[model samples]
Target chain A: MIGFNTVEKLKGIVVVVGNYGSGKTEVSINLAVNRKRAGIDVRIADLDLVNPYFRTREARKPLAKLGIEVVMPAEKYLKADLPILSPVVAGLIRRPSQLTLIDAGGNDVGATVLASLADAFRKTSVQMLQVVNPYRPFTETIEGCLKMRDEIEKTSKMTIIGIIGNANMIDETAIEDIYKGYDFVKALSDESRLPLKFITAPATLLAEIDTGRFSCPVLPIERQLVPPWIKAAGLKK
Target chain B: MGKILMKGNEAIGEAAIRAGCLNYFAYPITPQSEVAEYLSRRMPEVGGVFLQGESEVAVGYMLFGAAGCGARVFTTSSSPGISLMSEAISYISAAELPAVFVNIVRGGPGLGGILPSQADYFQATKGGGHGDYRLLVLAPAGVQEAVDMVMMAFPLAEKYRNPVMILGDGLIGQMMEPVEFSDRFKSEPSNKDDWATNGMATRNRKERNLVKSLFLDAELLEEHNLVLKAKYDRMKQEEVRYEPYNIETDYRALIVSYGTMSRVCKTAIDNMKAEGVEVAMIRPQTLFPFPIKAIRAAAAKDGCQVVISVELSMGQMVEDVDRSVQGKCPVHWHGKAGGEIPTPEEVVDVVKSFIK
Candidate 1:
């Protein structure tokens, strides 16, 4: 059994973060799709200020077409050098929807934006989580996870509600890899006191794993973010 | 194409658009404000959003909402603003979303001053959030790199589903330099509807989607964190990027730096070359997924006996270097943080001291 669909709906700021190639965007896209499929009004915001390529906001038009409220930086500021935060989000945080997801930049440096929203969080109970990829840097061990958690919380001024264990070996991820990742995140949860929200596996491997064992939930991730290779194919649609 | 002079902030804006990213979110801060000034007008032309956030905090949260819906979102800030954004960065990690962040760094520790400083090294490269995360960090030496990196950042951010940072200092952001555009670089369609929560019609087809970072139970969270660990590991192997200059020489010391600081080191290298100092420099283009292998290999070299970590800060990255060397060679620290950039002559002096 693996981390399966024990959880369908939850509340507060659901965040997604990881190393540069762990498919965090696909997970974000899938989670947005899956939960919305389950009937929850969702508003997703992209917070990454780290890298420019392959950001979730690139999918804004499609997300908007899906009728999902895609909160993002102003296109005018899209290419700005100096970061200019918008006040519109503060109003949203004060009164959250059924589901509000915050997609952040990678690492503590990029994740530090949480501090700016401290006032918004103080106004409401915001549940924060760290998306972990076992294969990424500083995440190979429980200690590394701890360090990462501390930095995020200390910087963001928000407590982490749990962990999202999404482990993959790039496009080569196997079902076994998902299982190993489940155990690893579980271990971190036990040591850190945060709960394990879910385990993610690509749609390709979703069928291979036993869905019964998980105490939390299982997310069937669909990768919409295209690598250069797949962009030209029919996937470009 | 021909090169044209541009500020680091303006370059970032144009480059991000050219990179195929349409959504931009951020808070205003000093020195880097040009980015906001430049983008506010451009967003409307392309049918994009450009909002002036309440604070760095809110902008970060806005980015989170946007990124979760599957969009290319970003923010830019100086030291103080970045400090305010630390909390949301952690949430972004928890959700495992992909986005780009730019830090036009200024001096700090309590808004020390608004000049250039690489002091945030520890915070930036080592995951500035609250969890076991490592953002792919890229330091651009010039305007072209600053712009080019934003183009690369989108795909890289999407490919790994992780945040990638374009890090530089005030000098870089304010300075003007010629840049050449990327070839065959514009985006089309912007087909993002697959998952974004735009309105009711989409949610009607399936269960309403919720983007949250909460887990009530202990066991579930543990299981979740492990998966992130695997992702970080993979990045270490695949995403670590750096630039090695004069590395082929038989040397006694290797100076490691990034962003504006590396340029200073370059000037020193030139002086040392004339003075017959065989010192090499290694600059990490990606600071988060640091070029550890290069550092390790440099430490493993025969004649490369000592490593001197230099930056605009109090040698924070030097600690990582020391960690990388693992005592193979004595990793020394030489830096001046809080807006004090060591001059090229000063860097040369540091090099001279280690000449023996």
Candidate 2:
């Protein structure tokens, strides 16, 4: 197993933004759970207003059970697609927990919401990381990845300091996909000059992988933003 | 290209392109606006036409115009948008034009919610429009199947020279899964020179092609209706498709389901088998030329006592199930329409209640 000490570097205000369907909500939930398991104070804001389904708020019960704070719109407006950023989001930004994670929506349109809270983010030591799933459409190549980064940065008015590789085919993920994903993000980090924060492998596949092959930490993804059917079957890893 | 993880909406757009469809017209609606978003950028790169009409009403006519010229055209919309387009759908069907329409169904009667629902079954399978016409409806359960269905829908539409509908739900549009675009389903566009309104000189024909739904003479209109009925009858014979699961186990209760809701029932059946309970399922891939014969045979199995139509709607498909069973055994409807999908545990309990 890989050491999780490197994840300790993810402190203060960290925002997860990426292209559509790049698994930002899953990564955000896992990061919050990982930090909480490490005995750190964590508060996550579900800022994904673009997507109608599969937002971080769907995992509120399990996350709350883990003693991690999950923030989002009020109950009345929970399922609404309206972009309602609660007052508590600014509070989370101003008075940062040990780990303050913002799971932004997908693409430039999604990240545009972050610009509204730019003033609150200015006061904090904020670091944004773009989650890259190489198997997805636009992020299949380094050039596409760079273009997305530019669009997101321009919209959010935030500087992305690192890259997080989250390559998988959902249930079809294999070891080769992980290694290839690691190599792709490694090349991306080299070309873009952004630090390689970490790459993720499904928790089920972690035991089969060698952590020494990569330079950055390996974040074991325990999928949380699944359909209700998968949830009822207890299929979560 | 190798397998790539794609949202169902985006995959539907790409699948149409790969299947030689270059014309797309749409109006944005959740949980399916992503299809328009993906194709808006993609169509330009592929030298295809992507137009966002002023409304779904206008978009329906856009498809009619393009499809009348024998162009392979399609549109994606949610429940309410489809309601607005049903008028055009009747016109297109009357003129016998080939077109594809995809409904990523959301909870609705009137903008009910943006969550997944299967309530549109009646609209898609029966006539949503004002006429005696039926769409060749294909329902896909997962993202990969969505891609395959979208690709196949084009050819299926052209083959029958009528509108074909791909019936999916919000989950099928929003969920991400790995898909590979294979050339297995690709085919050369069918020759439309005989009926297409592509101008006489273009095809070197002396007669101008006319496309219209209005048949003024009563006898001619009756003849046209009979012709349409023949085509529909042919479809009933050749196009029915379904998948039977766990039938070899001599299941006592048979479940009829489709789309995303069927996947939940599948999980329940698998789990129930381990607990020494035998439950079977029949998942319909085509809703219009529904697999009634197969369903009837499955329901008539020796030990089968009850047949249940499990769906995401209140009881839409159950009507078809009841008709298919024809009193072979008591048929029951078990589902929800409030956008809250019945979980596998709930499905197990629902089926268990009938068995005892």
Candidate 3:
């Protein structure tokens, strides 16, 4: 039943990586919050430098208020395109506590940066999750998702222990979409030989969804990291 | 149709496809790469062609080759990539081929930065490549406008037999907004049988059609120049488009802006109006056949004391503003280049200084 309780299984040094636009940031944020609410000491590192938009660091204020420490590069280099990995990311891996979540940059090019810190995870228990969103072009099919998983593992020098299904179209997602997405990810999990840790749905739609339909746990996503325009009107929290 | 939220880059791609443009070729560039990434999947579903060219230079000619065959085609790139495509753009322009190119402008003279900047105004409008030619540049201020302009670019290009550009910025390319596409615009491309290079055998015609910009003789070259100039002049007369804001009564200042920068200015104007300050604006939708007449008219308003050019660059478009004002009133500029966007509050503070 560990698959039905995904966040409960989140132990030391959890890293999330995925193709671009795969909603890894959203999963990272929700996972951190979920662990913290469960009375676990949580620290998340924003290792996303490939995308200037949609990053986990944008939720620093709210996460900090919830007693979750968000580690990131110095303030000046926050928006720079170059990858500036803080020493704290490796330091956390070496002496990880209850839960240390790393929100990695998107794509193989981004996962290449994770290779430098692979040694820290050698001595610790690590679970690298490849967030799969079938809505995105790169992970639309079973073959595409497998290709991405192979590429991420090769570049990061780490193996993906599980898969997270995060499929949604902003404001257009429906109850049927969540089920369809879950089925797609279930097929992906079967073919890729990875456990389905959990699947995500928007918090608004969580009440109507029949969780029995999915074999894995369902995590409710709070919409965050929106564009300047959407943030003006859509802060679901 | 109901509206759906979409990123500016992807929306432009969808709009281009909706406009009956079935061929897309481009190399990936930051801030605008989503356009290519989205089309790479959507194109095949629509039975269209989507290609990632070896380089931006190759992408340009691929667009030319496809456009020469009378295929509705387009490419999207950032500022530095646009510079690489300038030569082909000039060739496409002089050859009078109908193609659509979107430049999600970023800061630059040379790889300046990847953030949004309107530094390519002169290059897009006057001519980036060698030759006396102009691209019909269209600027969109938001995601919905970007979608509309891209859908409009195809027909306008074919109508004039010239290359059309949708000039945007990083902000416009990266942001998201709700948009609804009309079923009306989604149809087959118009006939290009006469000038298209579909092959002499296919057309079953005796005469051979040439698609080239070369003219060896001086006299013939002059004639070609004259013909091209005459077309541009007609465009100026027929295709000048702009939007005027808050010009009903005389105002203290007139802000001339375009594209994403104009949206920031609009926000600033609204904030200032709440504080009892009256400011008018003239947003030019077309940059090449600039709405000089509209800017002049706005500046000529009785109580309009200063004409301010708000832009993302240090002041590229201000020159046009100054020229349009023609020494009638004082002209000024406020901008930030190198990927630093001015906030609405910062813009309002500048407006306060101008009023004082």
Candidate 4:
């Protein structure tokens, strides 16, 4: 039945922002595609100004055929040092699709650029979400999250709508790691009141969880942001 | 079974399987590394594809490849690593595909520090990647909500043919809470294999669909944009999600917030009410599909004196508050962005100031 998120008619935009390694870009890609499968019109933009590594425009070839529109700085104007501000993005704000995702760069410095779109934000509805990871150095404590939230908001003149507890350990992670992180984030969520969004998981731990107790939604995490290791290991795909 | 403690990250992974998502991919990142670790061991048991990509960039594209095959794929990463995935995310949006992504967010501004921060709010809600598009943003306040969203995300993605996000910070990802997946999942058919590059079908002659984001010409781009716009227009008429807390209260103010931040506001509202300060909160469950109309009603109600926009960041959702108020009443803001959450007492103080 359409009651399932994959078929339900859910509309609106979702932005994925965080510090450099907070995984904003990865979140942006998956969220954009997933929404489309749910029967919603999804649009996306690559607004990162911090690095020159993998970016959305790089995947233009495949995304184009899917029929979803991608908005980015012109190829001719693309540069590592270019100030990412442009009038083109304003048009997107003016005419957002059922779901529009913005994957911003990391840090207060990166998110500060939202001030550039102050005009667009002033004209329409917007919700900014802060992604938090407990395993990261500075973000290990609740106080750390508060500090970062202040820095980003002050820089952009935008308020964070909520907090997303995305704590995780890479390949070496243990089930206990998730349990530990979940407890910490739950405390922060209780204290802050911002909804803790998705609790991301890899496929390995599905058997260990008795999922009936969680109150929020869950999102399956795919590692599409980073390149494949098999290919790097001299293996062919 | 009532409230078994579990990690948010693990719960998310398990919940997805329970929700019927069989494909998983990701790269290792700080704080969220367990997501990859967990999937590597479990995907095989469930007959799901679980591959740990070399870099965050590669993992993102792999999701693209899998999505191209019409599989319910997903990935996760953190701060600096997520920076590497923007390229593929933009492509995913452009393709209007179905998949799920998770960011166990960490703190940073060019690797400034590893910690929690609401800094990514603008990026998540405002189209973080390059495109004129939006992803349905689901902000779960706790582990339970996180589990519910996973079950919901796949169907939502398939129904809309777009990506969906469960924007969680480190706090949520790391936290422990009890969850029940058996009650969370209800199997449904997936359309991925039909066109998702399922080896070749000898019985049929359907074109081998290619999923791409390329629009080399202006006309084609324009057509795609128009089609997307129409879809969005339809969405406007169909989607609006929220939970009104204490809305039945009269007089005073409307406290607006989402995610776990609103919980702070709720405490403040409750505490302040002890001093006879009346306040209502309008919390949105889906950050992207914000409950705008709800705010308007709260504002136009008989005794509401003010609308307060509360959050982890300075005030990203403040603009929405202004829009809902329509200039009738001033919107107030109370937030702690860099990981600080205003105490109930502080929130009460803020709310009391709005008392008529």
- Give the number of the best model, judged by DockQ: 2
Q: Per-candidate interface C-alpha RMSD?
A: 17.0, 0.8, 3.8, 14.7
| Runs in model 3 lying further than 4 Å from the true structure | A1-11, A26-40, A57-80, A83-88, A107-119, A126-237, B1-5, B44-47, B179-191, B204-206, B246-251
Per-prediction tally of clashes:
181, 0, 0, 226
lDDT of model number 2: 0.91
Report lDDT (Cα) of residue B181, candidate 1. 72
Looking at model 3, give its docking quality level.
incorrect
The TM-scores that each candidate's chain B achieves against the reference are: 0.93, 0.98, 0.97, 0.91
The lDDT per prediction is: 0.73, 0.91, 0.85, 0.69
2 versus 4: better DockQ goes to:
2
lDDT sort, best first: 2, 3, 1, 4
Task: Between candidates 3 and 4, name the one with more favorable DockQ.
Answer: 3
Superposed by TM-score, candidate 2 places the C-alpha of residue B51 at a distance from the truth, in angstroms, of 0.8
User: What lDDT does model 1 reach?
Assistant: 0.73
Tens-digit per-residue lDDT, B1-356, candidate 1: 33433557878987887786788887777668768866885678777788888999998898889888877888888878877887888787777777888998877788667667787777887766787777788899878889989888887777666677778877778655556676555562243343345665744345554566687788978876876778888888887889999999887789998887788788788778887778898898887777877898887788876789888887688888887888888788888775656778888888778757
Candidate that beats the other on TM-score, 2 or 4, i.e. the better one: 2
Model 1 chain B worst lDDT window (10 residues): B188-197
TM-score of each: 0.58, 0.98, 0.81, 0.58
Quote the lDDT for B293 in model 4: 82
Query: Would candidate 4 be rated incorrect, acceptable, medium or high by CAPRI criteria?
Result: incorrect
Record all residue pairs in model 3 with backbone atoms less than 3 Å apart, i.e. clashing. Answer: none
Cα error of candidate 1 at position A190, Å: 76
In order, what DockQ does each candidate have? 0.01, 0.81, 0.19, 0.02
